[model samples]
Target: MVDTVSEGGAPRRGRFIVLEGLDASGKSTQVDRLAAWLETRGSHVHVTAEPTSGPIGSLIRQSFAGRVPLDDRVIAALFVADRIDHLTNARDGVLGFLERGIDVVSDRYVLSSLAYQSGDVGMEWVLHANEVATRLLRPDLTIYLDLPPAAALRRLETRRGIPDRFEELERLTRAYADYELAIEMLHEKDSIVRIAATGTPDEVAERVRAAVAGEL
Candidate 1:
């Protein structure tokens, strides 16, 4: 399982960096920029996101699109399943990349599950369900782009022609509150770095880079 070996014969592992925020918080853009910056420095960077393109992820997308009507518990379960697959898939998984000393920059991870799912199901249940994934794939650094729900909704309306089920202002507001509660409950105050996502992409990317400077 240990694939990375230092020049002095000591074991070393790559960093797992996760970016989390509400929809339209510019996470996707920042993740791309961060990965590109790391690759330019000769690092082996593997970039990915949640609701992966796997079978389970397809179902989650269907649920989001209203093509598949599912209970809250069922939807939450699907998220957990997709996460496990995302980490363990043989061909292209986070674990494989990390094992080979390739750093990972994920747009969204288990925290997204906690924030979004808690809006539908209670926070306690969502927390319990995500316990295993938390222990297994805990990010070395979590950058949370803290954007107000109203601003995020405006950004979504201006940018995306269509919004997903959870993109509405009301639902997003609730999810945002859930994110706050979950962050506290998970005791991520130290590991999770919050950045103001109100500025331009360039400005925000600079903050993101500064936040992860020590880890890199």
Candidate 2:
């Protein structure tokens, strides 16, 4: 469902794009670049991340850190709850910007839910939960930055801050393998364009932009 809005008394609608991958897959960098490129191209754009840093997002983050221990199913539900809130806010935020003809892009979306939760449950269940939670707000395009587990670990090591519990996960080989499986599952029904995330930021962003545009 699309929420149309008017910015400064001008009417417009926004396009929703999602970028997904495991940690260090260069999602953040590419999301930012896409938003900037969209703006430069005269499109109004808003960039956001999940867990959204909102109240729901905060709880999910805490749960992730083991600060608040919840069952895996509950944790998955919390993540979806955060998306409902984030999407609402994102809708409102984008509508205002879209009224000015802006596009909205997200660093991580339902795909992340599928990848992470698929590890816990079946891909079908993860997809079902996300579908129910998002009210089926599918992204127009999903750019999956595919990186090998070792390369991802390299990027993780160079990351500036202490790793979060998920980042500290040493079973990344399993997680990565799980991600690949999730990708296959999603490709069954959506436009999931895979890009090599093994290059420089600009290079990866270039590949992503090309893939997004090509898919769109």
Candidate 3:
């Protein structure tokens, strides 16, 4: 395991990296690529995603499928609950891995909640709900894959054959606007970097690597 010791007696925590973007922004693909790259460089990496594979996540998935009819505020609340569980679960959780000196890379994080949920619920309420989660598990780095809403919709249509609740053109346009506001509202602007996602997977990966070159 990699050594992480702070000036104090306690061990320094491992890095927490997050990938955020609208639907079909290639965040999932790049999360895997970044994890593989970190492993090759001898880092013990733990990869996870928000809307985690837990009870809350299950409800979120059902909501997406129109099976679970939750209001926007309830959906956002479930996201926060799942995120807390993902962080605090003793086994197979993000914090557990990080405490053991393993770097964590998440496919999506609080920024995504801010972007998507804020569109449905008002920004003030969404931000308040996420405040505790963000304080507890803020990413060390957040790479935003920037793509046009129309382009993202085309990609989803071509790849998935069916669109999910959040993949529509109008919602995506609004989500992008919320993302901009979220980025600006973040306490540390330097923690986030945007990369154009208008190229092949390999090309986008290259830009992601370049953006976090120093950390790597």
Candidate 4:
């Protein structure tokens, strides 16, 4: 018998995989590794992220650069709007890949909205808004990178790139706490798996691969 516990109305075709965490939790490394491995094994895998590359996604990215100072509520709504475009726009290619039996992996998803909006607005409001935004688009497997706030900060300091607006804040401690709380909420619903992200990128990637492989 198939597991009918996933969201999105008794589950449609395609497996939706999500990697969630704080800014420097090494989610990108793990996601890339997992996608490569899946492709190597003959699985059609497509890897992407939230704040995607669509028109709305471009605006969201610009907003992060301080070019667009939308209110917290507006930011949340914009994320949902961008997600709609990401999921539906034929040019975006996520739905197309999924339709072709390619597993869709994402760097962040609704969880990011929950953490950021909840930190700024409130958890209840974030949840309510997301329920409307995400309607039936939910992940089948959500791998959460569980890392200490201090470690995440260290990685951010050493990484070679321009930091976004959120990266320069002391809010990471609260963000880490919020992610942990969100993980707990997902765990209670049996929809999330926490991978310890306290080691090298390869180590974390292996752990994530193992987690996904076990589920498969």
Candidate 5:
């Protein structure tokens, strides 16, 4: 197990690292790579993602699947609620693992919310909606795997038949732009890192590893 207690025996909280990017920017692949690398260095790791399997998260998924209809404002609110549960729930929550010294790597977080919902509901509202979650549990590091929307769409085309609503070039492009605003809004307590998510996966992984070295 990764060491949780200091020399004085006080428990040290584990790092919360979140990866953010467009749909096909390889965030999931990088999340797995990062967790494995951390494990080799003796840190226990938990891999998780937003739109969790919880009740609230399930609703969010249904909305995404078009099985449930939701307005932009409602979707934004749901995200915040799901995130609150992810942080403070009594079981299997991010904070629970952090308290036990297991590093938590999430596929996405508040950044995703801002980048996605802001285009429709307005940036100010999205930011305010997430303010509580941001304060509830700030990520130690948020790695943005930066990639052009066109490039990301090309990558998505290789693997999927139908395009997800989120994968549209216009939506992806707006999300890419919104991320800049989101990052700017979060600099105070959020350690945001941008990695050029180009070239091969191995090359991108190297950049991610280098960016995470300070946290090790």
Candidate 6:
């Protein structure tokens, strides 16, 4: 239903696959690898990420970088606006690509907001804010790169000279717990696959490939 449409004589849409993980869990790297694999298998691919380069998304990044101080609730609200734009904008929006039969692989989607925002505000508030089932386009498949918070922190220190506001150990731990809850709650509707993220980037990509093969 999500990755395909069979109604109103519309063209067959491509799959919307999402890669989710805490900071430094190799999400960006895997997004590339997964897209490459899908292309090798002959599926046209479009890769994107949340906190897009759009106006609203730019504001969100400013907040993440500590350049713009904002309340947690405010940031949560920005995500909703950013996400809506990410999907519907005619210029390179996700729906535009998918509607044209090009597969879309995103680095993060609604699940990231659900997990990270809920860590700051309660889950009830985030759920009420997003209304994901109705407002956002749920991913056809979400592959979670499961890594311990401490390990992710280690990577952050070495990979980036300065950590962002959401890079704390406590926040990362809470986000992981939130991910578990979100996965359990949406498994039936979202078709999520959890792969252990401890290993080389190529190792994790292999697992991601296996999980995606099942859905394709």
Question: Model 6 Cα displacement at 15 (Å)?
Answer: 0.5
Instruction: Write candidate 3's Cα lDDT for 95-186 as tens digits.
Output: 88888778899999888988999878878888788777777777888999999999998888887444568978999999999999989988
User: Which pairs, if any, clash in model 1?
Assistant: none
Clash-forming residue pairs, model 6: none
Candidate 6 local lDDT, 1-216, one digit each (tens): 233444766657878999999999999999999999888887789999998999999998998888899998899999988888889898988988988888999999888988899878887787777785335477889999999999998888887455678788998999999999988877877888999999999899999999999876
> Which ten contiguous residues of candidate 6 have the minimum total lDDT?
1-10
Residue lDDT tens for model 2, 85-135: 776565454334434555778888887877777666667877777775456
Q: Best-fitting candidate, measured by TM-score?
A: 5
Tens digits of per-residue lDDT for model 1, 43-132: 778999999988999998988888889898899999988998898899998988888788999989888988899878888888788777
Stretches of candidate 5 above 4 Å error?
1-3
As for model 5, its CA RMSD to the true structure in angstroms is: 1.7
Q: How many clashing residue pairs are found in candidate 5?
A: 0
Q: For candidate 5, report its TM-score.
A: 0.94
Highest lDDT scorer:
5
Candidate 4: 10-residue stretch with minimal lDDT = 1-10
Q: Global lDDT for candidate 5?
A: 0.89
Please give the CA lDDT of all the candidate structures: 0.86, 0.75, 0.86, 0.78, 0.89, 0.87
lDDT digits (tens) for residues 110-195 of candidate 4: 88877776788877777777675456576878998987778778878997866776774467777777777777666654478888
Residue 173 in candidate 1 has what lDDT?
92
Model 3 CA lDDT for position 189: 51
Give per-residue lDDT, candidate 5, residue 132.
Answer: 83
Deviating ranges (above 4 Å) for candidate 4: 1-12, 188-190
